[model samples]
Target: MKLPKALAFDVFGTVVDWRTGIAEQAAAFLARYMPGTDPGAFADDWRNLYQPAMEECRSGRRPFRLLDALHLETLVQLLERRGIGTAAIGEGELLDLAYAWRRLRPWPDVPPGLAQLRKLFPVVTLSNANIALMIAMNRFNGLEWDAILGAEVSRSYKPTPQAYLASAAALCLDPQDLCLVACHHSDLAAARACGLQTAYVDRPMEYGGARAPDGSYEQAWEWRAGDLLELVRVFTSH
Candidate 1:
């Protein structure tokens, strides 16, 4: 396979371990705000609302909202469902908790893999995370990027062609000259449909120890590997 000039990554589960970060933070928050509840379950609950909230904007059911806003909305609903008073949680801490997505830790393999890939090709993030949130993650985790381009830049979400095209355009590259590397098959499929190349990196722990990812190298994709380090082996050899 010919190498592309640039690579765009899916940030959340693909680049960082959101489940662990969210669960730990949620546990700390719950210890103070609500006692004896399971933080890991709460993390899953918050994430479960992620796609549906974005779909509201993607389908035009609501005006475009940043991913931060969607995370807040879902957090509020979870609070209410748990019988915790949203007002009692207070506005400031509530906002901070919602933005916890910005503070996720990278997978153990991310730093070395991204560093190697950056040497091989221009690497930027292509994610549903809003720009501010993505930047915070970059700073928090020290994941250097050549550029950050995603839903905020395009005013669209993943699985939407506009987002992928906008990301490639931001780098002054054609769709085929950019590859979308992600843990989610749906995201890669969308990028493929938009004429961008696709690479699948398995993240079995993305859902924490409770669940496993759905796809394997057995599926048809332009590239498949255990992790980003393995991808480095592929592109660097070419």
Candidate 2:
């Protein structure tokens, strides 16, 4: 495959461990608000809402929304279910917690791998997460992206053609000239459909409490790596 001019990352599952990050933040929030809630179990419960929440939009039961909005709603519902009464929390707090994703910890290899890749490619985030969230995340996580981009600009999230096309167009590159690097096959498949090259980075611990289902790493990826640093080495021949 030809070298790509831009490297677009799938933020949530690929770059950061959203499950662990959300769980850790939820534990802190619960300790502060609800008090005594298990960050681990609470995290599992909170994440359970993720797919169903998106299904609501994809199924047309609700209109499409940015991932941030979906995440807040999920958190609120989780708070209530964990015996965390709604009156105990405020919308401001929910919003703040949603912003917690911006500060999420990168997988062990992310920062260093990015440092290596940045020297060879213009790195940017192509995520379902919104701009404010992405910017806050950049500062929080010490990410060094040359640019932050998202479905916020396209007004649609991943698996949507508009989102992928909009990213390449926004970056002023042909789809084939850009590579979408992500752990999720769903995301990279979308990029492939949009005419981009693809690389699959493994984040086997994205689910936090459990490993990703077996064979998830063996999808129809053009290139696969154990981590981002390995990916950079594979791409740059360094």
lDDT of 1 by residue, 56-169 (tens): 999999999999999999999888888888877779999989989999999999999999999999999898988899888888988999988899999999889999999999
For model 2, the local distance difference test gives 0.81
At residue 168, what lDDT does model 2 achieve?
88
Candidate 2 scores a C-alpha RMSD against the true structure in Å of 2.5
> Which one is best on lDDT?
1
Error of 2 at 57 (Å): 4.2
How many steric overlaps does candidate 1 have?
A: 0
Using all chains and alpha carbons, the TM-scores for the candidates as numbered come to: 0.95, 0.87
Give the runs in model 1 whose Cα sits over 4 Å from its true position. 212-218
**Each candidate: what lDDT?**
0.88, 0.81
| TM-score result, candidate 2 | 0.87
Model 2 is weakest, by summed lDDT over 10 consecutive residues, at 209-218
